[model samples]
Target: MSLYRVFDIAGTGMSAQSVRLNTTASNVANADSVSSSVETTYRARHPVFAAELSKAAAHQESAGVRVVGIVESEKPLTPEYAPNHPMADDNGFIYKSNVNVIEEMTNMVSANRSYQTNVRVADMAKQMLNQTLRLGQS
Candidate 1:
C-alpha cells in the first residue's frame, strides 16, 4: 500500500528465497552420498512456501512469503549395483541420494535471481523515500 510496505514485502521475499537457497544447497551437497540401506540414504529436500494474506474478509492482499515446511522427495533412490563398493548392501547394491544436480542447480539460479530482485526493489523504495523527503525540504 505504501512505499514503506514495499521494503517489508521485499525483505520477506529475500528471506524466503534465502531458505530456498539453503535447502537447494543442502540437497546439492548430499547429491553424491551413498548408503547401504534405503533408510539411511539422503533424499532431496524442498521448501514449501505459503502466501501470507493481509485480510481474510476484505481485499486479499499478500503480506509476504512464508516457508511452511521442508519436505523430502518421495521419488525412489537410485539403486546401483556396485558389487565392489564397500557400502554395498547384502544384495551388492547401494542406494544413492535422489538429488538431481541439474535440477538443484536450476533451483539455485532461480532463487538467486529472486533474491537479487528483492534487493533491487528495496533499494528503489529507499531511493524514492529519500527523493520524497528532499522534495518537501524545498
Candidate 2:
C-alpha cells in the first residue's frame, strides 16, 4: 500500500474514535436522568465499529475502521422507591438511567487516546512522505 493510504486509514480511525467519544459523553451527561416509566429512562449507548478488510490478497490493501451503529445497553434500568419525588410513577416508583459513570469515563479516556494515536500516525505518515519527496532534492 502507498503512504497515502496510511492517512486514509488514520482518518477513519480518528472518525471512529470521535463517534465513540460523543456517545460516551452523551451517556455521562444523561447518567442522572430519571423517568416515571421504564420506556423513557435513558440507557447507556455505545458505538459499534467494524474493520473494512480486504478481499483480495494480491493487492494487500490497508484496512480501515468504520462505525456500525450506536446501540443502547440492554442492562435493566434502576428502579427506585421514591414516592415523594415529583417524577415518581403512580405506583411510587422512579426509573433511573443505566449509565455507569465510571465505565463511561474509562471509555472516554480510551477514545481520547485512540484519537491521539491516530493523529500521531497521520503525522508520522506525512513526515515520511515529505522525507521521501525531499530525497529528490539531494
Candidate 3:
C-alpha cells in the first residue's frame, strides 16, 4: 500500500472516533436528566461502527473502521418516586435516563485513545512521505 493510503485510513478512523466521542459526551450530559414518562426520557446514545471493507481493500487490502450510526440504548429507564417533582407522572414516578456514568467515562477514554493513535499514524505517514521525497532529491 502507498504511504498516502495510510493517511486516508487513519483519517477515517479519527473521524469515526470523533463521532463516538460526541455521542458519549451527549450520553454523559443527559445521564441525570429525568422525564415523566419513558417516551420523554433521555436514553443513552452510542455510536455504531462498521468496517469500510471495500474502501480499505481498494487502498491497502485491509479493513478500515467507519461510523455506521448513533443508536439509543435499550436498557430500561430508572424509575424514582418523586411526588413533588414537576416531571413526575400520575403515579409520582419519574423516569431517569438509562445512561451509566462509568460506562460513558470508559467509552470517552477509549475514543480519546483511538483518536490519538490515528493522529499519530497520520503524522508518521506524513514523515514517511517527506523522507521518500528527500530520497528522490538525493
Q: What would the per-residue lDDT of candidate 2 be over residues 1-138, giving only the tens digit for each residue?
A: 788888989999999999999999999999999999999999999999998875324467667999999999999999999999999999999999999999999999999999999999999999999999999889
Candidate 1 CA-lDDT value: 0.93
User: Could you arrange the candidates by TM-score from highest to lowest?
Assistant: 2, 3, 1
Error of 3 at 130 (Å): 0.7
TM-score of each: 0.92, 0.94, 0.93
Q: What Cα-based lDDT does every candidate model obtain? A: 0.93, 0.94, 0.90
Model 2 alpha-carbon drift over 4 Å, by segment: 55-62
Highest-TM-score candidate: 2
Report the poorest 10 consecutive residues by lDDT, candidate 3.
55-64
Q: Candidate 1: where is the Cα deviation over 4 Å? A: 55-62
lDDT of 3 by residue, 1-138 (tens): 788778878988999999999999999999999999989999999889887788765765646787878888999999999999998999999999999999999999999999999999999999988999999998
After superposition, the stretches of candidate 3 with alpha carbons farther than 4 Å from their true spots are 55-63
